[model samples]
Target: MGLRVQVDNLMEHHSQKSLFAVVLGEMQDGGLPHIGCRCPRCVSGRVGYAACLAIVDVRGAETAVYLLDATPDIKYQLNPLAEWLGPHPQRPNRFNPPTAVFLTHAHMGHIGGLPQLGPEAMAVDGLPVYASAELVALLQETRLWSPMVQGLALRLFSPNQPIPLAPDLTLTPIPVPHRDELGTGTFAFLINGPGKSLLYLPDIDSWQAWDAAHSVLQTVDVALVDGSFYSLAELNGRPPVAHPLISDTLAFFAGWPGELVFTHFNHTNPALEPNSGAVATIQQVGAKLAHPGMRFLLD
Candidate 1:
């Protein structure tokens, strides 16, 4: 088995314009699938996806990569991550591109990388993709997504079920409310691998949407939650296409029994400018903003 578990917890930062490339994910080859632009709001636009994350294998014999959300800039995003892994040719089967990908919704930013995944591209064999039943069916029935669903096996998972991806890593999908064109069943993954566990729900509409009947907050070691917008009135770009704000989310986590970090930022949100009042407020509540290279060590 391989040895370190890491979450490429990256995000693109911008003020009224672009900021430093703390962990910038660049799109090097091929044009993005949907709309294109060069402005800060366009390039770093929340919907277009300024940053994408790739979860690399730390210890498994299969050096697989699990893509949490495939941002529009994926072609550029995969290059750096692949380079970082380099080629361990001498080591048996150490350089496969990625074993599979897991998507949250049908948003262009989330699944825009699907084309690259087909036979014409990576030519991956049955790259098992995980998503809700509705999301899978929609991808299958739709013209744009039909090829991807057929070219690669799109594994439709039931809400609140667990699927094992590695000897140590299993993904638990927590259903969240969202506006999926097919139907809403946005999943919050409970990724448990060997000794570490992480909870991801980066696109929920609000905390009030959860099932208060159960104590879902204490179920994991760490949470990377929806911080798409800072407030309802921030009224920035594209209205999330449908997602929640940070204010309500932060309050929900105030009583959380585990560590909660935020991700999926919008350009208009003040939190984009680090150390701004918005950033301070989030930190004051004992929560952290998701840092791209952040790693969690489990015993």
Candidate 2:
């Protein structure tokens, strides 16, 4: 099986998760889901607040595509993954193995993609979407989302529980602390293949809150940590809420004992400037930035 991720664009984070997109696979249909669409610099795409990250089949054959964080750009993100996978609007409602959808959290950018499961898009008869219990509850409690789930037949699973995704793939949910406004319960994912592994953490309030006393840190091939804001110093205009910035995140990785990469950035974060002096500081710590079009092939 082939696995890779592609970025659509970097977002502008003033209020929400203003970050970028990362594409996992291209579509079998024509170039309808173009990455350049909707970026601040791209006139051809839509204006977006979140970035779309997709995981695709490596050989351009049959494979599963998981949209890491749904993002406000959910339509743009799934447009490609659905078309590429066998679940497009024109395809039959046949379930395929090794296929699954994992949600990182309840935030709009994370779970907004839930609606695409309907007949309007994927026509997924009963697509199993793995999310925390609270997230499923939140969706059920809300108005629009509640109806969406009730109609789509989305399945909820507990965090930290490993579920088989394919004959050779398994996914485990790792809950991370974040602003629990929606009460969906936040999480990072650990996807394990036959011999490869990956950790996906997008929006955590602080690493210190995660598994506080557990050892979930030392066990993965690639750990994508948070990159929301650069530092506490970046909080200039914001009134006070409680959350850690990218600076605090940098501190966590200083001692982390695994291959670590950082993503989910905000405009306030200095790491956006790929060549900026502040980003250079993040690099000095041995942590890396997750940008559009960067792919990691599992060994």
Candidate 3:
């Protein structure tokens, strides 16, 4: 059945698990069911949360959990991992915050959930947040984000430098071209687990624009790249969108051996529907659409 269900089944069957990454969301920044749009997909209630991922390692006595991109739907996204997080040691009837959070960029969908970690919600103390130097400065120096920053330990990392999460687990941020506002750059995380590696690239302009697209993607065991729009028709009369179409992406990566799973879909994307022809085309090529709750074991 769906990858999400498969993940849940796998989690239940495993008494002890290894390093893995879970698909917390698969939709674009705004997520599905756009604010005022009455599109078929939005009305169908088949929409999903914005792009987010959770990396979990249960090999240790206490499960270690980290999140990639703090999306707007952080609350619901974090709920499924409550068992792994355990309970807050100081607070009763509350879950402990994730070990850390790594942001891909300063985009709203990527960092909007930081407020939830402030006084109003989790009120986490000393929670580690890894981001680019510019992003770290923007958040720490901005008055609006001061409250949240006070509770977080911001770590500024340069692109291409690997941040070791564990002895064997490392994450390297690779600069990628995207719609960058506020002068903060964008990144696609390359997660190197003990045995396997996956690239979590939710947003990008065009694959051709990237110099190392082929070299980086081909080296990973799994590549979850952007599939924001399936075709130009989805834009209607609007100017051409920034993201690469699914057709173009498929053709661009033709014959690449790594497994491809498309994520960060727009609301109007027909591939969001399981029975759509777009899905058939993608599946025919051995690639699949990302679904919430989907998990990929590193080993």
Each model's lDDT: 0.60, 0.56, 0.88
Q: Where in model 1 is the C-alpha error above 4 Å?
A: 1-52, 83-95, 212-214, 236-241
Tens digits of per-residue lDDT for model 3, 9-113: 757855476889989889898987887889887787665789998899998878889999999988878876777888988888899999999999998899999
**Collision pairs in model 1:** 1-59, 2-58, 2-59, 2-60, 3-58, 3-59, 9-292, 10-292, 27-76
Task: Report model 2's TM-score to 2 decimal places.
Answer: 0.73
Give the Å shift of residue 248 in candidate 3. 1.1
How many clashing residue pairs appear in each of the predictions shown? Answer: 9, 22, 0
Per-model TM-score on C-alpha atoms: 0.75, 0.73, 0.96
Query: Per-residue alpha-carbon lDDT of model 1 for 55-166, expressed as tens digits?
Result: 5554434345677756566555565455334465564543345556778777765777788766675555677787778877788888977876566777878777788766
RMSD (Cα, Å) for all candidates, in order, is 8.1, 8.7, 1.8
Full ranking by lDDT:
3, 1, 2
Model 2, poorest ten-residue lDDT window? 10-19
lDDT top scorer:
3
